[model samples]
Target: MSLFRKITETVSKGVSTATEKAQQTVEVTRLHSQISGKRREIEKLYVSMGEAVFRGYLDKDLSRAETKVIPACEEIVAIRGEVEALEERIMQLRNEKECVCGRKVPYDTRFCPSCGHPFPEPAIPAAEDPLEEFDRQETEPSGLSSADPFVEPPGYKDPGEAPSASDWADVGKPVLEEVPSAWSDAGQATPSFLDDADAVGAERADSAKCPGCGTAVGTTAKFCPSCGTPQQ
Candidate 1:
Protein backbone atom coordinates (compact mmCIF):
# COMPACT_ATOMS: atom_id res chain seq x y z
CA MET A 1 0.00 0.00 0.00
CA SER A 2 2.85 2.41 0.85
CA LEU A 3 4.65 1.59 -2.42
CA PHE A 4 1.51 2.32 -4.40
CA ARG A 5 1.12 5.67 -2.63
CA LYS A 6 4.73 6.64 -3.47
CA ILE A 7 4.25 5.76 -7.13
CA THR A 8 1.00 7.79 -7.31
CA GLU A 9 2.66 10.87 -5.78
CA THR A 10 5.62 10.66 -8.19
CA VAL A 11 3.29 10.29 -11.18
CA SER A 12 1.22 13.30 -10.14
CA LYS A 13 4.31 15.45 -9.65
CA GLY A 14 5.58 14.45 -13.10
CA VAL A 15 2.23 15.32 -14.74
CA SER A 16 2.09 18.78 -13.14
CA THR A 17 5.66 19.54 -14.17
CA ALA A 18 4.88 18.39 -17.74
CA THR A 19 1.81 20.66 -17.93
CA GLU A 20 3.71 23.69 -16.65
CA LYS A 21 6.50 23.01 -19.14
CA ALA A 22 3.98 22.81 -21.99
CA GLN A 23 2.45 26.15 -21.04
CA GLN A 24 5.87 27.76 -20.79
CA THR A 25 6.73 26.51 -24.27
CA VAL A 26 3.57 27.99 -25.75
CA GLU A 27 4.07 31.39 -24.07
CA VAL A 28 7.72 31.62 -25.14
CA THR A 29 6.88 30.70 -28.74
CA ARG A 30 4.16 33.36 -28.80
CA LEU A 31 6.59 35.95 -27.45
CA HIS A 32 9.16 35.15 -30.12
CA SER A 33 6.59 35.19 -32.92
CA GLN A 34 5.28 38.59 -31.86
CA ILE A 35 8.79 40.03 -31.61
CA SER A 36 9.67 38.54 -35.02
CA GLY A 37 6.59 40.15 -36.56
CA LYS A 38 7.61 43.54 -35.08
CA ARG A 39 11.11 43.07 -36.47
CA ARG A 40 9.65 42.33 -39.90
CA GLU A 41 7.47 45.44 -39.75
CA ILE A 42 10.54 47.53 -38.97
CA GLU A 43 12.36 45.87 -41.85
CA LYS A 44 9.51 46.69 -44.19
CA LEU A 45 9.62 50.33 -43.18
CA TYR A 46 13.33 50.38 -43.85
CA VAL A 47 12.75 48.92 -47.30
CA SER A 48 10.09 51.54 -48.04
CA MET A 49 12.46 54.31 -46.98
CA GLY A 50 15.15 52.87 -49.23
CA GLU A 51 12.73 52.76 -52.12
CA ALA A 52 11.78 56.41 -51.53
CA VAL A 53 15.46 57.36 -51.51
CA PHE A 54 15.96 55.36 -54.69
CA ARG A 55 13.03 57.14 -56.31
CA GLY A 56 14.49 60.53 -55.39
CA TYR A 57 17.89 59.44 -56.66
CA LEU A 58 16.32 58.43 -59.97
CA ASP A 59 14.58 61.83 -60.14
CA LYS A 60 17.82 63.69 -59.25
CA ASP A 61 16.33 65.30 -56.09
CA LEU A 62 19.23 64.51 -53.77
CA SER A 63 18.69 67.05 -50.96
CA ARG A 64 14.94 66.41 -50.61
CA ALA A 65 15.72 62.69 -50.71
CA GLU A 66 18.30 63.00 -47.93
CA THR A 67 15.89 64.90 -45.71
CA LYS A 68 13.18 62.25 -46.11
CA VAL A 69 15.42 59.20 -45.80
CA ILE A 70 17.64 60.23 -42.85
CA PRO A 71 14.99 60.04 -40.10
CA ALA A 72 13.65 56.72 -41.41
CA CYS A 73 17.20 55.32 -41.62
CA GLU A 74 17.91 56.36 -38.02
CA GLU A 75 14.68 54.76 -36.76
CA ILE A 76 15.37 51.55 -38.67
CA VAL A 77 18.88 51.20 -37.31
CA ALA A 78 17.71 51.79 -33.75
CA ILE A 79 14.95 49.18 -34.12
CA ARG A 80 17.38 46.70 -35.68
CA GLY A 81 19.74 46.96 -32.70
CA GLU A 82 16.89 46.46 -30.21
CA VAL A 83 15.54 43.44 -32.10
CA GLU A 84 18.97 41.83 -32.35
CA ALA A 85 19.58 42.25 -28.66
CA LEU A 86 16.17 40.76 -27.84
CA GLU A 87 16.72 37.73 -30.09
CA GLU A 88 20.17 37.08 -28.65
CA ARG A 89 18.82 37.27 -25.12
CA ILE A 90 16.01 34.83 -25.94
CA MET A 91 18.48 32.40 -27.49
CA GLN A 92 20.64 32.68 -24.39
CA LEU A 93 17.63 31.97 -22.16
CA ARG A 94 16.69 28.88 -24.13
CA ASN A 95 20.27 27.61 -24.12
CA GLU A 96 20.49 28.05 -20.32
CA LYS A 97 17.33 25.97 -19.81
CA GLU A 98 18.90 22.90 -21.41
CA CYS A 99 16.23 23.42 -24.06
CA VAL A 100 16.40 21.37 -27.28
CA CYS A 101 16.75 23.41 -30.50
CA GLY A 102 13.62 25.56 -30.98
CA ARG A 103 12.22 24.20 -27.70
CA LYS A 104 11.00 26.64 -25.06
CA VAL A 105 11.59 26.67 -21.29
CA PRO A 106 10.63 28.65 -18.21
CA TYR A 107 12.39 31.98 -17.90
CA ASP A 108 13.72 31.28 -14.37
CA THR A 109 16.22 28.73 -15.66
CA ARG A 110 18.88 27.25 -13.32
CA PHE A 111 21.37 25.43 -15.54
CA CYS A 112 21.58 23.99 -19.01
CA PRO A 113 22.88 20.44 -18.42
CA SER A 114 22.83 19.77 -22.20
CA CYS A 115 24.74 22.77 -23.67
CA GLY A 116 26.02 24.42 -20.44
CA HIS A 117 24.64 27.89 -21.46
CA PRO A 118 24.07 30.38 -18.63
CA PHE A 119 20.74 32.12 -17.99
CA PRO A 120 20.14 35.32 -19.92
CA GLU A 121 20.12 38.50 -17.90
CA PRO A 122 16.81 40.33 -18.02
CA ALA A 123 16.87 43.26 -20.44
CA ILE A 124 16.35 46.73 -19.06
CA PRO A 125 14.04 48.61 -21.36
CA ALA A 126 15.38 51.88 -22.76
CA ALA A 127 13.32 54.97 -22.01
CA GLU A 128 11.65 55.59 -25.35
CA ASP A 129 8.74 57.79 -26.37
CA PRO A 130 6.73 57.74 -29.59
CA LEU A 131 4.05 59.96 -28.06
CA GLU A 132 4.99 62.85 -25.81
CA GLU A 133 3.05 63.19 -22.57
CA PHE A 134 3.08 66.78 -21.39
CA ASP A 135 1.93 67.42 -17.81
CA ARG A 136 0.31 70.86 -17.69
CA GLN A 137 -0.52 72.63 -14.45
CA GLU A 138 -4.00 74.07 -14.15
CA THR A 139 -4.17 77.87 -14.04
CA GLU A 140 -5.83 79.55 -11.07
CA PRO A 141 -8.94 81.55 -11.91
CA SER A 142 -8.34 85.30 -12.31
CA GLY A 143 -11.47 87.48 -11.93
CA LEU A 144 -10.65 90.08 -14.58
CA SER A 145 -13.27 91.18 -17.08
CA SER A 146 -12.84 89.19 -20.31
CA ALA A 147 -14.21 91.96 -22.55
CA ASP A 148 -11.87 94.73 -21.32
CA PRO A 149 -8.12 94.65 -22.01
CA PHE A 150 -7.33 97.10 -19.20
CA VAL A 151 -9.43 95.41 -16.54
CA GLU A 152 -7.71 94.99 -13.18
CA PRO A 153 -7.06 91.49 -11.83
CA PRO A 154 -9.22 90.08 -9.05
CA GLY A 155 -6.34 90.08 -6.59
CA TYR A 156 -5.27 93.63 -7.39
CA LYS A 157 -4.49 95.44 -4.16
CA ASP A 158 -4.59 99.22 -4.05
CA PRO A 159 -0.99 100.41 -3.69
CA GLY A 160 -1.85 102.35 -0.59
CA GLU A 161 -4.48 104.53 0.97
CA ALA A 162 -5.92 103.46 4.24
CA PRO A 163 -9.20 105.36 3.87
CA SER A 164 -9.58 108.12 6.42
CA ALA A 165 -12.91 109.83 7.32
CA SER A 166 -12.51 112.17 4.32
CA ASP A 167 -11.96 109.43 1.67
CA TRP A 168 -15.04 107.45 2.82
CA ALA A 169 -17.17 110.62 2.62
CA ASP A 170 -15.94 111.28 -0.94
CA VAL A 171 -16.87 107.81 -2.35
CA GLY A 172 -20.53 108.70 -3.07
CA LYS A 173 -19.81 112.18 -4.46
CA PRO A 174 -18.75 113.05 -8.03
CA VAL A 175 -14.96 113.04 -8.71
CA LEU A 176 -15.34 116.54 -10.21
CA GLU A 177 -16.83 117.86 -6.94
CA GLU A 178 -13.84 116.64 -4.87
CA VAL A 179 -11.39 118.69 -7.02
CA PRO A 180 -10.19 121.93 -5.22
CA SER A 181 -9.74 124.12 -8.33
CA ALA A 182 -10.66 127.79 -7.75
CA TRP A 183 -12.87 128.17 -10.89
CA SER A 184 -15.07 125.09 -10.36
CA ASP A 185 -15.66 125.49 -6.56
CA ALA A 186 -15.86 129.29 -6.67
CA GLY A 187 -19.67 129.35 -6.20
CA GLN A 188 -19.32 127.52 -2.83
CA ALA A 189 -17.37 130.51 -1.47
CA THR A 190 -18.68 134.10 -1.87
CA PRO A 191 -16.82 136.06 -4.55
CA SER A 192 -15.38 139.51 -3.67
CA PHE A 193 -17.07 141.33 -6.58
CA LEU A 194 -20.74 141.54 -5.40
CA ASP A 195 -19.91 141.85 -1.65
CA ASP A 196 -17.48 144.78 -2.26
CA ALA A 197 -19.05 146.30 -5.35
CA ASP A 198 -19.99 149.55 -3.48
CA ALA A 199 -16.45 150.00 -2.05
CA VAL A 200 -14.83 149.40 -5.48
CA GLY A 201 -17.20 151.90 -7.16
CA ALA A 202 -16.13 154.60 -4.72
CA GLU A 203 -12.37 153.81 -5.26
CA ARG A 204 -11.95 153.11 -9.05
CA ALA A 205 -14.98 154.87 -10.67
CA ASP A 206 -12.84 156.09 -13.60
CA SER A 207 -11.42 152.58 -14.37
CA ALA A 208 -14.86 151.04 -15.22
CA LYS A 209 -14.39 151.68 -18.95
CA CYS A 210 -12.56 148.99 -20.96
CA PRO A 211 -8.87 149.85 -21.65
CA GLY A 212 -8.81 147.87 -24.98
CA CYS A 213 -12.10 149.09 -26.59
CA GLY A 214 -13.42 151.81 -24.22
CA THR A 215 -16.55 149.76 -23.40
CA ALA A 216 -19.08 151.42 -21.00
CA VAL A 217 -19.78 149.63 -17.73
CA GLY A 218 -23.63 149.82 -17.85
CA THR A 219 -24.87 150.45 -21.37
CA THR A 220 -27.36 147.49 -21.38
CA ALA A 221 -25.00 146.20 -24.18
CA LYS A 222 -22.50 143.27 -23.95
CA PHE A 223 -20.29 144.84 -26.73
CA CYS A 224 -17.93 147.86 -26.46
CA PRO A 225 -19.28 151.41 -27.04
CA SER A 226 -16.48 152.33 -29.52
CA CYS A 227 -14.92 149.19 -31.06
CA GLY A 228 -17.56 146.54 -30.12
CA THR A 229 -15.21 144.48 -27.92
CA PRO A 230 -17.35 142.49 -25.47
CA GLN A 231 -16.79 142.83 -21.70
CA GLN A 232 -15.22 139.47 -20.90
Candidate 2:
Protein backbone atom coordinates (compact mmCIF):
# COMPACT_ATOMS: atom_id res chain seq x y z
CA MET A 1 0.00 0.00 0.00
CA SER A 2 2.91 2.46 0.72
CA LEU A 3 4.57 1.68 -2.65
CA PHE A 4 1.27 2.43 -4.40
CA ARG A 5 0.97 5.79 -2.59
CA LYS A 6 4.57 6.74 -3.54
CA ILE A 7 3.93 5.97 -7.22
CA THR A 8 0.70 8.05 -7.19
CA GLU A 9 2.51 11.10 -5.62
CA THR A 10 5.33 10.96 -8.21
CA VAL A 11 2.79 10.93 -11.09
CA SER A 12 0.91 13.88 -9.59
CA LYS A 13 4.11 15.93 -9.26
CA GLY A 14 5.10 15.19 -12.90
CA VAL A 15 1.64 16.30 -14.14
CA SER A 16 1.88 19.55 -12.15
CA THR A 17 5.33 20.30 -13.55
CA ALA A 18 4.17 19.74 -17.12
CA THR A 19 1.18 22.04 -16.60
CA GLU A 20 3.42 24.85 -15.23
CA LYS A 21 5.78 24.50 -18.19
CA ALA A 22 2.88 24.71 -20.63
CA GLN A 23 1.59 27.85 -18.96
CA GLN A 24 5.05 29.41 -19.13
CA THR A 25 5.31 28.60 -22.83
CA VAL A 26 1.94 30.21 -23.48
CA GLU A 27 2.97 33.34 -21.53
CA VAL A 28 6.22 33.58 -23.47
CA THR A 29 4.31 33.33 -26.77
CA ARG A 30 1.90 36.07 -25.70
CA LEU A 31 4.79 38.37 -24.73
CA HIS A 32 6.53 37.71 -28.05
CA SER A 33 3.35 38.56 -29.91
CA GLN A 34 3.02 41.82 -27.99
CA ILE A 35 6.62 42.73 -28.77
CA SER A 36 6.02 42.08 -32.47
CA GLY A 37 2.90 44.24 -32.37
CA LYS A 38 4.79 47.04 -30.74
CA ARG A 39 7.56 46.78 -33.38
CA ARG A 40 4.96 46.98 -36.15
CA GLU A 41 3.46 50.06 -34.50
CA ILE A 42 6.89 51.68 -34.39
CA GLU A 43 7.44 50.94 -38.08
CA LYS A 44 4.04 52.49 -38.91
CA LEU A 45 4.96 55.58 -36.88
CA TYR A 46 8.21 55.89 -38.80
CA VAL A 47 6.35 55.76 -42.11
CA SER A 48 3.78 58.33 -40.97
CA MET A 49 6.50 60.69 -39.72
CA GLY A 50 8.39 60.35 -42.97
CA GLU A 51 5.24 61.22 -44.93
CA ALA A 52 4.68 64.30 -42.74
CA VAL A 53 8.24 65.53 -43.35
CA PHE A 54 7.85 64.91 -47.07
CA ARG A 55 4.63 66.93 -47.12
CA GLY A 56 6.38 69.80 -45.35
CA TYR A 57 9.17 69.65 -47.91
CA LEU A 58 6.65 69.76 -50.78
CA ASP A 59 4.97 72.80 -49.18
CA LYS A 60 8.35 74.51 -48.63
CA ASP A 61 7.67 74.69 -44.91
CA LEU A 62 10.41 72.30 -43.71
CA SER A 63 11.07 74.35 -40.57
CA ARG A 64 7.77 73.19 -38.99
CA ALA A 65 8.68 69.54 -39.54
CA GLU A 66 12.29 70.12 -38.39
CA THR A 67 11.00 71.34 -35.02
CA LYS A 68 9.67 67.85 -34.29
CA VAL A 69 12.19 65.77 -36.21
CA ILE A 70 15.37 67.47 -35.08
CA PRO A 71 14.85 66.60 -31.44
CA ALA A 72 14.18 62.98 -32.31
CA CYS A 73 17.27 62.90 -34.54
CA GLU A 74 19.36 64.43 -31.75
CA GLU A 75 18.06 61.79 -29.33
CA ILE A 76 18.97 59.08 -31.81
CA VAL A 77 22.46 60.58 -32.12
CA ALA A 78 22.83 60.59 -28.34
CA ILE A 79 21.70 56.96 -28.11
CA ARG A 80 24.17 56.01 -30.85
CA GLY A 81 26.93 57.76 -28.95
CA GLU A 82 26.01 55.79 -25.82
CA VAL A 83 26.03 52.58 -27.83
CA GLU A 84 29.49 53.40 -29.22
CA ALA A 85 30.77 54.13 -25.72
CA LEU A 86 29.40 50.81 -24.50
CA GLU A 87 31.06 49.06 -27.44
CA GLU A 88 34.36 50.73 -26.53
CA ARG A 89 33.95 49.57 -22.96
CA ILE A 90 33.32 46.06 -24.18
CA MET A 91 36.41 46.21 -26.36
CA GLN A 92 38.48 47.42 -23.41
CA LEU A 93 37.21 44.53 -21.27
CA ARG A 94 38.16 42.11 -24.01
CA ASN A 95 41.68 43.60 -24.19
CA GLU A 96 41.15 44.44 -27.89
CA LYS A 97 40.73 47.49 -30.10
CA GLU A 98 39.37 48.09 -33.55
CA CYS A 99 41.56 49.20 -36.44
CA VAL A 100 40.65 51.67 -39.17
CA CYS A 101 40.77 48.70 -41.55
CA GLY A 102 37.66 47.29 -39.82
CA ARG A 103 39.57 44.57 -38.01
CA LYS A 104 39.76 43.75 -34.31
CA VAL A 105 43.29 43.54 -32.92
CA PRO A 106 45.05 43.36 -29.58
CA TYR A 107 45.14 46.66 -27.70
CA ASP A 108 48.92 46.81 -27.70
CA THR A 109 49.19 46.25 -31.46
CA ARG A 110 51.16 49.09 -33.11
CA PHE A 111 49.91 48.41 -36.65
CA CYS A 112 46.96 46.80 -38.36
CA PRO A 113 47.98 43.38 -39.62
CA SER A 114 45.21 43.44 -42.24
CA CYS A 115 46.00 46.81 -43.85
CA GLY A 116 49.47 47.73 -42.50
CA HIS A 117 48.00 50.93 -40.98
CA PRO A 118 50.11 52.35 -38.17
CA PHE A 119 48.32 53.19 -34.96
CA PRO A 120 49.04 56.47 -33.20
CA GLU A 121 51.28 56.17 -30.17
CA PRO A 122 49.43 56.16 -26.87
CA ALA A 123 49.85 59.44 -24.98
CA ILE A 124 51.95 58.80 -21.87
CA PRO A 125 51.72 61.74 -19.49
CA ALA A 126 55.00 63.32 -18.50
CA ALA A 127 56.04 62.19 -15.03
CA GLU A 128 56.14 65.00 -12.45
CA ASP A 129 59.48 65.67 -10.77
CA PRO A 130 59.20 65.09 -7.02
CA LEU A 131 61.54 68.05 -6.25
CA GLU A 132 59.89 70.55 -8.65
CA GLU A 133 57.45 72.02 -6.07
CA PHE A 134 60.19 72.32 -3.47
CA ASP A 135 62.54 74.01 -5.96
CA ARG A 136 59.86 76.57 -6.97
CA GLN A 137 59.15 77.51 -3.33
CA GLU A 138 62.88 78.04 -2.70
CA THR A 139 63.44 80.17 -5.83
CA GLU A 140 60.40 82.48 -5.37
CA PRO A 141 60.87 85.69 -3.33
CA SER A 142 58.91 85.78 -0.07
CA GLY A 143 57.82 89.45 0.29
CA LEU A 144 56.70 92.46 -1.72
CA SER A 145 59.13 95.34 -2.52
CA SER A 146 58.99 99.01 -1.39
CA ALA A 147 56.31 101.38 -2.79
CA ASP A 148 58.87 103.89 -4.26
CA PRO A 149 61.65 101.55 -5.36
CA PHE A 150 64.65 103.04 -7.31
CA VAL A 151 63.77 101.13 -10.53
CA GLU A 152 63.40 103.66 -13.38
CA PRO A 153 61.12 102.86 -16.32
CA PRO A 154 61.77 104.09 -19.85
CA GLY A 155 61.15 107.92 -20.20
CA TYR A 156 61.10 108.27 -16.37
CA LYS A 157 61.90 111.73 -14.94
CA ASP A 158 63.02 112.94 -11.45
CA PRO A 159 60.43 115.12 -9.60
CA GLY A 160 62.92 118.00 -8.94
CA GLU A 161 64.63 117.96 -12.39
CA ALA A 162 62.78 120.09 -14.98
CA PRO A 163 62.56 118.48 -18.45
CA SER A 164 64.71 120.41 -21.00
CA ALA A 165 63.51 121.50 -24.48
CA SER A 166 66.16 119.18 -26.01
CA ASP A 167 64.64 116.22 -24.11
CA TRP A 168 61.24 116.98 -25.71
CA ALA A 169 62.93 117.39 -29.16
CA ASP A 170 64.57 113.92 -28.87
CA VAL A 171 61.12 112.31 -28.49
CA GLY A 172 59.54 114.49 -31.27
CA LYS A 173 57.08 116.02 -28.72
CA PRO A 174 55.88 119.60 -29.10
CA VAL A 175 56.73 122.04 -26.28
CA LEU A 176 53.36 123.25 -24.89
CA GLU A 177 52.77 127.00 -24.64
CA GLU A 178 52.08 128.45 -21.19
CA VAL A 179 48.57 129.94 -20.99
CA PRO A 180 47.84 132.95 -18.73
CA SER A 181 45.43 132.16 -15.88
CA ALA A 182 41.99 133.82 -16.08
CA TRP A 183 42.12 135.03 -12.39
CA SER A 184 45.76 136.20 -12.44
CA ASP A 185 46.89 139.45 -10.74
CA ALA A 186 47.96 140.82 -14.19
CA GLY A 187 44.30 140.54 -15.45
CA GLN A 188 45.26 139.05 -18.85
CA ALA A 189 42.83 139.69 -21.74
CA THR A 190 41.05 136.71 -23.47
CA PRO A 191 42.90 135.26 -26.46
CA SER A 192 41.90 136.81 -29.83
CA PHE A 193 41.54 133.39 -31.56
CA LEU A 194 39.08 132.20 -28.87
CA ASP A 195 37.01 135.38 -29.32
CA ASP A 196 36.98 134.86 -33.07
CA ALA A 197 35.77 131.23 -32.66
CA ASP A 198 32.91 132.39 -30.40
CA ALA A 199 31.82 135.00 -33.00
CA VAL A 200 31.84 132.34 -35.77
CA GLY A 201 29.73 129.96 -33.64
CA ALA A 202 27.20 132.75 -32.90
CA GLU A 203 26.90 133.58 -36.61
CA ARG A 204 26.27 129.88 -37.47
CA ALA A 205 23.58 129.62 -34.78
CA ASP A 206 21.80 132.82 -35.99
CA SER A 207 21.86 131.64 -39.68
CA ALA A 208 19.39 128.73 -39.45
CA LYS A 209 17.90 127.55 -42.81
CA CYS A 210 14.31 126.43 -43.46
CA PRO A 211 14.19 122.74 -44.48
CA GLY A 212 11.22 123.33 -46.85
CA CYS A 213 12.69 126.20 -48.93
CA GLY A 214 16.40 126.06 -47.94
CA THR A 215 16.11 129.81 -47.30
CA ALA A 216 18.11 131.37 -44.38
CA VAL A 217 15.99 132.40 -41.41
CA GLY A 218 16.30 133.35 -37.71
CA THR A 219 17.09 130.58 -35.25
CA THR A 220 13.70 131.05 -33.48
CA ALA A 221 11.60 131.44 -36.66
CA LYS A 222 8.38 129.39 -36.55
CA PHE A 223 7.66 129.48 -40.32
CA CYS A 224 9.67 129.58 -43.54
CA PRO A 225 9.83 133.23 -44.88
CA SER A 226 9.60 132.15 -48.55
CA CYS A 227 7.49 128.95 -48.66
CA GLY A 228 4.96 129.63 -45.83
CA THR A 229 5.93 126.19 -44.37
CA PRO A 230 6.26 125.60 -40.60
CA GLN A 231 9.94 125.51 -39.58
CA GLN A 232 11.27 122.66 -37.46
- lDDT (tens digit, per residue) of candidate 1 on 1-232: 4445555897999999999778768767876886788788787877878888888889988676777678877888888777766666656645533344443444554223233344556689988553432322225445666785776889665779475686678677765433322232335755546658877776565445755645444333343434434554
lDDT of 2 by residue, 4-93 (tens): 555589799999999977876666565556555655655655666687799899999977787767665665566556556655665665
Backbone clash pairs for candidate 1 read none
Taken over the whole model, the C-alpha lDDT of each candidate is 0.61, 0.68
Candidate 2: residue 231 Cα off by (Å): 96
**Ten-residue segment with the worst summed lDDT in candidate 1?**
177-186
Backbone clashes in model 1:
0
lDDT at 78 for candidate 2? 60
TM-score of each: 0.38, 0.33
